[model samples]
Target: MAIQFIKKITFNHPQSLLSFRLKTTSSQYVASRFRDATFEKFMDHYKNLLKVISIQDLILANPKNNPPSVSVDFINRLSQKLHLNRGATAFLRKYPRIFEIYYDPTLSKPYCKLTPTAMQISIEEAAAIQNTHPLVIDRLTRLLSMSKSKTLPLRAIFKVWRELGLPDDFEDSVLAQNPHLFHILDAHEPNTHLIKLVGTTPGHENFTAAVENWRIMECCKDECSVDRTEMRYSFRHGFPPCMKLKKNLRAKVKEWQKLPYTGPYEEFTNMKKRSKTAVMEIEKRAVAIVHEFLSLTVEKTVEVEKISHFRTWFGIDLNVRDLFLDHPGMFYLSTKGKRHTVFLREAYERGCLVDPNPVYVVRRKLLDLVILGRRGLRSGDHKLSSSESEEDDDLLEMENDQGDIL
Candidate 1:
């Protein structure tokens, strides 16, 4: 099946002038390794936060939404589906600010519902998604543009839809509404489809990569030391403080920084993967592609496994895990939960997203509710003691420090 798909797509293009300049001596080096504690903690928090959000959505979508509550017994029956390591009741109780437990006199049983604050925040989140509809369309278009075939599998897009801030009915509401921009075609597999750009021109081909914009901004700053051209191709690195670079490694990194390669939006179809230089350029282009994708994401992170679904669609002919692991300075792989997540290191500071988008800002309010726990409860509500909250913080710090270096 994969072979058939590959045969159908052609990745040929006229060689660009930039291709000849990259055919220089290429030095081989082992993958550079480092770890950031801050990003690990960020991922750790999201591990449970994401599960909580999923459960919240499930409750909200229930048919019995008149009271917007579900029986404890019902939730417990689907504990495995919720991915809860603990009992459903216990898990729901952990975040009192988001979930409230109450006894129903008529039903004579305990039921869970979103707290008032959580419900309000949920409304705001919906509003934010609605307001950012245009941005979501633009992001989706740029993503398809980055692919070698100017198209991507609908399944692949669905996997990262939440991260891209796409609406649940984006296929009908967004794509269907923008017929001039996108077209959905049936795939060879049953129930599968492909989303292809409707009209791609030379202007679309010349769109600037996210990293290139960052470089341009840096070059405009008075304190910038690197040349504009060098910065354009080079990636920003945020190595851990504990990492000590050897002289040889430093030289290799310097050489890599100055290496010229095609941007993620540009095509490098004429370059063969046989030579060392071509191999290096291809690897760098993969980094650029992943970097640009994360840049388009609300959190600047995505599960490593989710990206694997795009290997064929994106024309990335290498292991995605190794690609991220090879470029630790540009990316950080966090094994915090069942799935590993890749983060764009430059997009974060300490532990927060450096540039928070509107959708992300609304989503963070939901996370803040989870982090608040029982403290956000009102009078007569279940609440944690101050000491218990402190204990929780200590445990989180301990977990964050575990396996600090990778």
Candidate 2:
């Protein structure tokens, strides 16, 4: 109702001026009457004014006099910068891999892993055949369980299932028949095997049994094996054991207070998406931390793989964190609440590529792993049914093509 809310519209008629003056006086009086404690009471008045006056213009002009600390305009800008659109919530909820990202070894942090070893195996055997290896089967089942949930991301399910080289759309079809897989996986523990390797309780008997059956199917390829009931009991690490939840990541972060860092950065990087502005903010903060650490030349960063997730925004993916190849130190990016920034810690171990170019190399490596595995499967399938050997054809094609690229 403020005259400022009316913008710079020229008064065409005498009646319009009278209306404007009345509105201005009322708006000024209302603003003067508004107190700090009455923020909620005055929101409706501003919202109505926002329709006519652009938020940016009002900001520049300093209208309302009593500006809310958080405005709809600010939220709109935040949504744009953070890439929070309609699909983001569903995508976050639906991707089990996204959930896996949350299952960091740190427990409380977003943890995701890249299965480089499985990519290695896809060249030799189908996952159906490879499930014969107990360790491999256990790993496979862990990957499979992720997809069983209706809440799971279909894309992640398909990708993992394909890499395992099961029949097309196997996970989806399986889920279509049994919809409860989602709820089951959501409740399951990640270290169930290691737990069995330790022990289980009466309460955990059900969890133990499911894990055992899943392992047997993967290792023995005997999903329908009749003696699973006895086998589940046989391997149980006896007794009324209790899970100590305090040993988890949440507790650790709480105990640590704040992670050791230079400033305005986190100790880990695990955001679902990376925007240009956010990534830059993280990089700047990380670089500042690195500058501080490097300033103390005597301090060593024992290198290991600084871990990260491939975050896709607008369909292009990038790894949002880095660390030295041999150092225990790491620089990670974390998305917590409205802010996402890179973190640096001296103790977190990850093989960091100090070259500052991990985002490109890591993505290419991941893509090559997928594409090469897919190509090998296709080539193998063709070779089995063909009269002409595919290897011979590949050799001839390579010879002919080598001349052009060279």
Candidate 3:
């Protein structure tokens, strides 16, 4: 389902209305030591692993199935239906511990069965979902609060569920159950929906505080500045420890950072808006909102463009790639996986998130199970080795060539 945004919601004031435009710039695909390689590796390793889990879940949920073991042919067909380029046979062989491969000698065919370990993991994941229900709601609250219209199209929300660490069908299961917190609106497009926060303002106290804190830090750095060129570099202290800066690159970044900007949360609706100034502020606030959003995530990072879906709502009418390039100290853009993702520099240290969540721990454990299965297969420790047909060569294709996936 696609979200057909009929019109971007704009502030009534003409002063606030600016044509959304972004200046195109060449991107330097850079890597940082604090890029949370483990998380990235897990996601890459499980890209198809999770697909298998989703398939298993779908099969198990079928009321007609008694044992819930789906045939290999059924999984192959389901893979096509789900657009899973990675064939089910390869996936089962890749993660034998999760998917019990039962072959009937007479028929010479394989049946995909969920292993006990996988079953246990499902139970643990369910428990984690139950435990983190409140946090998930709070996460939803913050997401809605950050939007300019204080609402998000349901289709957009669905796309970023994995990044948000939300369970499948959360809109129906979790969101639908909470009528007092969220209101689902029927849009002109059938099955397309909009989600609005109930009785809540768009402004979030935490985001406001973060903006103030950043300002205070900037001011303190300004006091010790040597010159205009050096003044911009003064804020380099805010950069994460892993950010190794080259002198020439540092100068270039400082010059870009010196551009005048306004806060994302500030009342720009009444201000005399210079197009360049408004754009800079909008981009800055986009950064701030993203920073705050990531802070609330179990992992303090998200797909770069996933946050861009709120561009209209956030009043960000500029290229987000420019923002990441200009503000390397604040955010780290990683091209590790299929998508280029943005990570909060300060929130991560030594390839791991500095602030870890319990739910993340549970998820990590589940990931470990998948990794162990792969290890077992690699080591030939498992007797379930089956030569499966290979496919999904582009399963790891880059999601976008530029920053416009938003």
Candidate 4:
């Protein structure tokens, strides 16, 4: 097999290497753990991490400048929705910066709201969401284009719409407004709809190039080989080098890779009776489809469970975990949350995403502010001013602050 790196294609300019460089000891430690841990361990760690993120998400999901305080009962309900094993009420009380607990004694309810700093973070996050609205449309379009039907169920799209940076009611706000680019089709079941692309867009071209580029690279190994026996291990060329110890693994992968490439627009109706080669092609495309979907995300990461909800639409038959285990170089499973999540490896470096969306840049600032707020809360300093908090955020100043933020 040829020992060659996939020629890096510049999707967008990466952030300044100096700014995103991992300098923190804790970050270095986490990166090291990720590299050494097995896939199952990584997933367990991720699930634990998601429990905290769920609390953060709940606070951020609130609307209004002075968001209504949520009750302990509300948090408990959310725990069930997010599949969190622990009591969210207790978690909220533990993390004051993320959730400030107060009792509405007359109502006999314990209410929780974002700390002052969390509120400030939410305000800034709203601005970032508005700023990245255009990019969100493009990203969503890319996702729709990569689907086997060139359409996706509204339920599935809504599941990740927030993560993808789309507004809560994007179907009405973004999709409805862009009639030329998108439309909706009612499914047999009422209230369930599919989002379809009106015509071929740049997303289709990019998805095609991305999948074809990978295929061309794989086929290149075979092109240069003179010995038929050497082809036995060729399929393993694209897989992570760690899997070489599993005997016959390369042989199985070689056979799989030889299957024909299927475009996202193609149908896989008779999948059960399809020839082994045809079935292999569907699975291969599923890997590429997942890769393309991750690339379209603002963070280049998505909850693995969210992808599972769209398996039928995306034509992915295998479990989402299996896909990541099979393609290590293309994807990295991160234990950063309570749920299993996967990230595009080529999009990250030194623990930071290489090609971060503009909105992500703002979100980073919000995170810094949240961390500062946490410190202040831990120290029992409730009177911290917004200006002081902003100063402590450690963000670079822009020439036109108002314009840059919007």
Candidate 5:
């Protein structure tokens, strides 16, 4: 693949060599990852990664404050470029362990060893931290009694439950009442294609089956620490690290719980770690913000319209394929009323579009003529360049405050 070592010193400047400020990111990375993988392999690897790396996650992790200001769309395009989304989630869901595995906080920290022994975490705090339902305390206590052994095979305990004719639906009811617990029990489900229910539990076989291949584990420790150590277990699962947006969403959504979820912190943490779709969460919010900020609406949807050609407000039309070869910038849309004036410029050539222009136009809303380029921003405080000549000069790269494309 053709590549260039983009220097990282351009964030505070606009004219750096690798800094061409545009609305899109390059699609080359996507093309490369997809080149040789079989349909199945590509679907599993690339699609999962895309679901794992959301737009919001990308923006949050690689904020403009950081050096590698990669574009979220570019990342998605890369995943799609590899032709991985073809099979959708079913194929990838089977290989839940493709990403890293983490532990459940109700157990021990993820790296700790898993012990078959189950200890009862106090019901009081469990309601708060675990998102546990208030009605299930008795069931929990009973389960804890069955799990007291330091190394009881989970299968054995469930077998005993089954022998006792304790219905699996009873467990499901408890889980349904407490989704938090379900997240915990199901967290390890994502690590393998299909988890086999084993050990010495009776009424627990079907109970265990319900949680197979779910992805729910925590990444941090403080959230998992209990006042008592026995309250936890060593957690483990095969789930990718939570993307940025997932964390943000967890932070936002978990706060609104009606009753405290009585699941392990690892469970909440694992919910924080979902498929690649997490990354787009923030950008999706930002887009919403921009729409509200600008009072913009999708005035109309043009169906069956051919994108055979488009150009800038200047009325120049170019085929989509030759957009870059002719314009050397990027493709952009300016919406006024029901019509979206299509155009190509530096952005179309180099690469993409989002609501806020680019992070450089960091305000939640963008108005007036905004030109995104690879130009490095000057100081954290910036004044929009009033230089009309600069606006017209697409070929010229932006310079840092030092006035060099360094």
Candidate 6:
């Protein structure tokens, strides 16, 4: 899909890069326009990582089996749904350190199970989730508080639970423990559930955005003379090396960054004027809200469509894509797979999270396992044929190339 998108663009010169000229609802042309290959590669890697993790979760979901093994036939039947490009047997065989295929004599068929290392990593992930329960609750509460009604659909929350680092049994494990802060009530729609914030929790009433904290810390670290008010209204910008901002565009962005606007956690619905200045401030507030949302995620990123699911609830009326494109320095849009993913530019350095969370650390371990493939297996445990060894080397080389950009 990414390849096809690239092919459709016509570059005028050899140095020309992928660019878009999107018009926002206010009929203003977006000044920033360029793609960042680093982020695109980052999203491409996660695309496969997410698929591997999903398959892992599916196998782990069935705890009835003593060792949690599933039949190879079952996975084969659901390969398409699992989004596996290759056959199930081949895919499982590729990541030998994470999965093991063995013959089940009683069933007269082969079954798949997590290898010891993978199982250990899963255990660690569970522990990390438990240890970070309070942080998870805080993130969830902030998410709910951003909405107009201080509520979000249960189904929508389920869609982003993984990104937000919520546990599998969040309803019972997280929400049930925080009755004072949250409540699950049936929505007006039949069979729908809504998770609503009861009121402002005592300590959380003055919740500060992650981005805001970072800005202040950066200012303090540099000992800059910039006023606190100006810092409050400003955001850091980091454009890709390939993008060259025009002189006029740079000046405009500098002015825009200094514009005073409502913070993400503050109220903005009171301003309903249709003047150009009012519209711009509202748009800036929308950007701040999205920025804060991404800041709360474990990886500082989310699928654009997944975030769009909460648009109405968050009172963001502009096109999400346009907003991301308009501020290339603050956010990056990656159309690497079928979905578009937006990354918080400041949260990541190169291809890694700047301040890794406990959950992200464990998840990275799983990703490493996938990237290492059979190389991670014990030398004497499994022997690869010449052709298989060559294949593994090729896979490693490809991953290494992507790693360089990440």
lDDT of each: 0.80, 0.30, 0.63, 0.63, 0.26, 0.82
Please give the distance, in angstroms, between residue 245's alpha carbon in candidate 6 and its true position after superposition. 1.4
On the 0 to 100 scale, the lDDT of residue 192 in model 6 is: 97
For this target, which candidate reaches the highest TM-score against the unseen true structure? Answer: 6
Q: Which stretches in model 3 have alpha-carbon errors above 4 Å? A: 1-64, 67-69, 77-86, 104-109, 167-169, 201-244, 248-272, 275-278, 376-406
By TM-score rank, best first, the candidates go 6, 1, 3, 4, 2, 5
Candidate 6 lowest-lDDT run of ten: 22-31
lDDT tens string, model 1, 1-406?
9986455443433363346444543121212245466776676668888888888877787746666878888888888877787889889977877888889888899888888988898888878989998788888989998888888999999999999999878999888998888899999999999999986433554577788887878999998887777775688987778777789877887888888888878776857457988888888888788889989998899998898898777778888888887777888887776777888888888888888899889989888776665553334646545676667766875664675423
Kindly list the per-residue Cα lDDT of model 3 for residues 1-406, writing each as its tens digit. Answer: 1233323324334443443333222542343234433335434544555566577766577636445677788788876665466787776787767777777666678777777877777767777777787777777777787676778888888867766767776978778888877899988888888998885423444444344555456567847444544443123325544457789977765555565544444444533666866655555556666666766677676776777776676666667755665676777666643566776767666555666776666666666666554542434556534434112222222332122222
In candidate 3, which residue pairs clash?
148-313
Whichever of 5 and 6 has more lDDT, that candidate is 6
lDDT of 6 at 374: 64
Off by over 4 Å in 4: 1-67, 77-86, 103-109, 200-260, 263-277, 334-338, 365-406
Please say which candidate is ahead in TM-score: 1 or 6.
Answer: 6
Q: Which portions of model 5 miss their true places by more than 4 Å?
A: 1-183, 186-381, 397-406
Q: Which is the winner by TM-score between candidate 2 and candidate 6?
A: 6
